[model samples]
Target: MEISTCTEKMVQIIANSTLEKSLKKTLKEVGVSGYTLFDVRGDGDSGDQSGHLEGDSNILMMVVVPLKTSQNLMEALNGYLKKGHHLMVFSVDAEVLTPSKFG
Candidate 1:
């Protein structure tokens, strides 16, 4: 059995419908059918916001898959990130206690 995990951070202009669409397309291309996304707020070198930056939001997506699938996902994401779009991708070792949950 093989296991792996990857996380991708994407920043989309506020109210941009294409963000979700792009994510779905990328996920499908990478062979990752399942993922979870959460809304997040933060301050970076760019500046600080009193509360949620205006016209900007962050989406964090996490996917856990078998080693082979994870590699494919990362390759697809590389092209996206190279466009200089506001995004980040990272991966690390992971262990799934219940394999059925991923299936």
Candidate 2:
């Protein structure tokens, strides 16, 4: 048996839940093939997001994409931050199996 794998980037964005619809639209426009969004709670400059209220909560959006696509995605996300949207975005190197699935 053989295992096939490739390197990519796992981009993670933590932002206000109120931006879910807009964020999803951005992801699609940025050409992200797939992603995962989770209701999450955390403390930050904006204080604690308890996840008890949809509008006041936070969401963690994660996506694994090819290196080139990652750059485009980052640029799109940065646009949100520039607009003063409450968002935290970062990316880490990832070793992904079946990389085409992420492309």
| List of clashing residue pairs for candidate 1 | none
TM-score of 2: 0.91
* Best-matching candidate per TM-score: 2
lDDT of 2 at 71: 96
Mind giving the per-residue lDDT tens digits that candidate 1 earns over 10-45?
222221223656877788776776777766556664
* Regions of model 1 farther than 4 Å from truth: 1-18, 45-55, 100-103
Evaluated at residue 85, the lDDT of candidate 1 is 60
- How badly does each model clash, as a count of residue pairs? 0, 0
Every candidate's lDDT: 0.57, 0.88
**Candidate 2 lDDT, 1-102, residue by residue in tens:** 989888889999999998999989998987887899899998879998998876779999999988888899899988988998978888999988867564
What is the number of residue pairs that collide in model 2? 0
Q: Lowest-scoring 10 consecutive residues by lDDT in candidate 1?
A: 9-18
